[model samples]
Target: MPATAIDIGTYAVKVISADPGKQPNIIRTVETLNPHGIAMPIDDLQIEQVGELVNNIVFDNKIPHADIRLSLPESIVSSKVISIPPLTDAELASAINWQAEQHIPIPKEDLSLQYKVLYRPEKSKQEQMRVLLIGTRKSLVDRFINMFIAMGIEPTLLETHVLSLLRSLDIGADEPPTMVLNIGATNMDVVVIFKGEIQFVFTHSGAGALLTKTLQQTLGLDLQQAEQYKRTYGLDPNQFEGRVRNALIPVINTLTNEIQKAQRYFASQFPQNTLSRIVITGGTSQLPGLVEYLSESLGTEILFSAPFASATGEIPQENQQTYSVCLGLLMRELA
Candidate 1:
């Protein structure tokens, strides 16, 4: 049996088994419900339901005592990829602390910092490691830590949604710099990778909800109808396509601009880097014609990321393509 990591996402609670070489079996996954019949936003859920959902998933799955890999919301954590001369683990830890102070707006004393070393190839004395340093308010970190402790589980690795999403992309050793985009309920996390390492990541609010709101406003449709239209007609301008393209232009423009900015900065730093492909994941990534629209707009080949690349013949092929992040959490141990 593999160790388990439970990801408490904004939209749902996902319990993933950390099997490394095997698929991260979905021990349990459930969307929290509001008793009042009004679907409360993730942030507005009562505190008890958060714990209840987690506990129920763990119990229902008969999962106990696995190394948990929980995700901190993008708003709670700060992420930056910094390059530094290769050093001993001790030196890296100290350097990351100083680097965190420079990049993170919060005072160092108020936050807990962690770093993941991305690329430090063996060979040269001048080789540097591209490190992803994450900083979160001490209080917030404590709350999550305590939440697991209260449930009798201790997380071995606590990461942000961006890290988990990037982990899901299955970047191969021979692959070139690629862009990974994850569109969630209310936020989108974009990470730029080169040579199987992350160079930059940015999180943006307004993902599916924005599209739904646009449809609701422009077409005078309810939320469910708008969502259905978005899934069916995304960015298409045909008669059945509705006005989604016009409504989503602003949001897509903003997303494209952010990607452009990251690409520009990445190019200036690594002039020789070649971008190979763009990977899109998450629920909204399933939007019809969205990939083609992005390809035309961004001028790059687009691919939908399937997170089960590392797993063997465990999960059925059909469901493997979806649940990339939940599966990636389980595969992190393998990586």
Candidate 2:
């Protein structure tokens, strides 16, 4: 069977259809500007409108709607790793629900929780295991479900943006601890992965739209021209006589500050493991000079993620970075 994945990012709606088996073949990919509403919706009417846009994109692309997969951005969900005292499998099951109450902000009833035991501590005095807790608002889940129902289709899988973005990478388990920064339109999600385990997930409001808006205000340019200048001369010192770069520097600095905080937190948690690489993905990640800016700011190797890095054949690279979550969703079934 073939599966289709959709990620409704604020700036674009990204789609990927693949044939599912041992090796999923890339069938088609679609990217469309989210004309319904550029800003992500919080209310029902807006969600409904976006849902229609999603449906129309799929239908317009002539992609298969069955075996559908979806990804929700970091803004709407909570991901936390909690430590628990040693207990039996059955006991741990009971413990996580209680742990969710303590760690996740969503109420017990409104929360939909998922967990995985990452790894147990060494032969130490206070022996305990760490668990990854992923919780989403039930109403949010309901919103996605109802939105799909309006299209007469049900999604087979749903995941957070960070998880799906990580899945799209070719990161190796033997590799050193790495930081993945998803600079999406609405939110910036920083994830620390060590030995294939999630060490930390942090979501921040410092993101692409902020940079664009900063340029808009500082350069006294309209929204479209500001965005154009941003994409053209992003942090490129020589491009705009340092005027555009000057306006964007503060915003980029603030975002890098959050990344540095993640680095410190990762170092504190895993004293032995140092973050060696930083992977930048999402639409805005490709802004000119942005990668160089991050590399210089963080003093680490920075890599841009392409959607089909692991897949062979005629896979186009246009919009590759922004389609991370959607491609990873297809792989959730295909790979």
Candidate 3:
């Protein structure tokens, strides 16, 4: 069955549909954003505005009874890396639920959790397997369902942002272990993938908004001006200084610290595994000198995401970068 893709985040929701054919067909690709003005105060009016914007995109595009593959934002999802004895499908499912009950804080009834087995090297015993499990609050899940239903769509599949981003990279089933970082408005999520299996996932409290606030307070600029400055200066010592640089220091330090911790943990656990690359994604990833900074700090090869890494269709080159997750969702759903 073909898949429609919908990625709903705090800042925006993107929808794309692909049809089944010899060559991948793009049925529709549309996106709508929550106005930047409403980022600080998410109120009834802002919610209504977002609903209207979503409605307009669907109506204008004439997406009829679409079947969507949805992605949850990192802010609202819980995930972990766990090693379990390999088992049959039924046993794996049961084990995952039991594990979630033990590890996830929410009551079993209030959360929806699922897991996928990770790829392992051929030399390892088949029974020693790694898995990625994710849990989302039922309340949050229902809200997204309601919003999409109101727009005349029903999701056939639902997953987290990390999965979608990995799909965008087309990391092969046997590829080396790698890490991906998504820098969004509200938070930064670091995901570790070893030999195509997600080994760990963690989120940082501050992200793009933190930097924006730093600029606003230190430079006495408004949100828009601060955001512009961040994109312009972005860890570059020469371009920004004084309080501006000082304010950014905390967030940058925190970001690097998390990466170091993740790397160390992966190393200690999987002594033979090597982290060959790092991929950066999301809006804040456009920061002027972030790639260089992260590489220098982490001492690894850093790759900026080109969202359309493995899909077909001629999107304008400019939009191709950020829409990678949305496109990946479409490809996964329809392929």
lDDT of 1 at 76: 70
Error of 2 at 4 (Å): 0.5
Per-residue alpha-carbon lDDT of candidate 3 for residues 143-219, written as tens digits (9 for 90 to 100): 66666676666767777888777777776658778888888777788988765567789888778788898789877
Instruction: Select the stronger candidate by TM-score from 2 and 3.
Output: 2
TM values, all candidates: 0.83, 0.94, 0.86
A best-first ranking of the candidates according to their TM-score comes to 2, 3, 1
**Structure candidate 3, residue pairs in collision:** 3-334, 307-324
Put down candidate 2 lDDT per residue, 11-90, tens digits, no spaces: 88888788753245888888888866343466788877887888788887888987998887788888998777776779
Task: Report the number of the highest-lDDT candidate.
Answer: 2
**TM-score between candidate 2 and the true structure:** 0.94
- TM-score result, candidate 1: 0.83
What is the C-alpha local distance difference test score of each model? 0.69, 0.82, 0.72
Evaluated at residue 228, the lDDT of candidate 2 is: 91
